[model samples]
Target chain A: AQTVTQSQPEMSVQEAETVTLSCTYDTSESDYYLFWYKQPPSRQMILVIRQEAYKQQNATENRFSVNFQKAAKSFSLKISDSQLGDAAMYFCAYRSAVRYQGGSEKLVFGKGMKLTVNP
Target chain B: AAGVIQSPRHLIKEKRETATLKCYPIPRHDTVYWYQQGPGQDPQFLISFYEKMQSDKGSIPDRFSAQQFSDYHSELNMSSLELGDSALYFCASTQGWGRANEQFFGPGTRLTVL
Candidate 1:
């Protein structure tokens, strides 16, 4: 079974400072997808960024970027100029490229890293 | 943009009772997935459906059953609920079956089994 690991259980970042949340996964499949999702106090889960395993280039979405190291099986999320709104529980999820059992390409998520923005 | 919708944002139920949760997928979407998130825990995949058919399953309990309707809507029926069943149940939808499609998640229904 594939598993995602997030070593940091809690992290604090100064407002306007930069922060990185680390993630690692165990998978033998060559083709897959990695994603970072943010769950705010409202409990709504929002997609932050995504990276394709086949792509060598890292994925960036405005202030959110990912450092994807395929060989190391590491996918880290970097938030530049972190804002108070960035304070949330962030999750790293893994998705397989192929659909198993007709449509079970569900995401495998890590335990999550709680990010606190200090003003 | 419109997003997935789940009914009964909060539900309180007694142990061994039955509860049903409904999900309305986004227009034109053909796939729906169910997930359970315990307190302070990551969401766990429960099951998935494609075109109103059971496509895959995960750690769903035998007491819980779900199905996707022809209209792309879905429902999770929980019978003989236990206290451990209390959690936030989320419904996500995606277009098509394969490929790296981004899933749109619903606000989720919070179930409190007493």
Candidate 2:
């Protein structure tokens, strides 16, 4: 069994500033994938970024990036130059790399952190 | 690029009533996944299909049933609905069974039980 943990329930940052949301997971599998997703007021789940456990290089997508510490079981999201539109509930998710029963693995998600960007 | 499609963006059903949700995966995607999101809670995996066959099961209730058709579209049938079942139902799709492929999520169907 695998579980993702987001310790901080909520966080706020001033516009144009940067903020980091922390996440950790428990998994015995060596090969797995981690992701960060954002849910806005519309309730749409949007993928922010993803990282593979086998890759040491962090994943970056424009202003969004991940600091993946595999040995520490930590994967955190860094939002640089935050904007009002970035205010949303962010979730950290995990998935195993091994295919089970001929199907792709299911995602295990954290409780989510509410991010508020104050103007 | 085409994205995953889910119909009846909003549904209102009474307790003990039944509802059916539909999902149309992006063209060429062979896998479909279903998830449930409660109010102010993280999404939980319910079930998944691969190539029209049941692949994985999660916390889905026995009163609920789902299947993927030959066309790659999937339907989730819920019976004896309860207040707890009134949540956002999301359908996600992926092109293959690869380990690193990102799952594209649908807009999700919001089912409200009264």
The lDDT, on a scale of 0 to 1, for candidate 1 is 0.94
In candidate 1, stretches whose alpha carbon ends up further than 4 angstroms from where it belongs are A99-103
lDDT per residue, candidate 1, A1-119, as tens digits? 78999999999999999999999999978888999999999999999999989999999999999999999999999999999999999999998887532324989999999999999
Candidate 2 residue-wise lDDT at A91: 98
**Best-performing candidate as measured by TM-score:** 1
For the second chain, the TM-scores of the candidates in order are 0.98, 0.98
How close is candidate 2 at the interface, in terms of C-alpha RMSD after superposing the true interface residues? 2.2
Number of the predicted model whose DockQ against the real structure is largest: 1
Q: What is the DockQ (computed on Cα atoms) for candidate 2?
A: 0.65
Docking class of 1: medium
Candidate 2 residues lying further than 4 Å off, grouped into runs, are A99-104
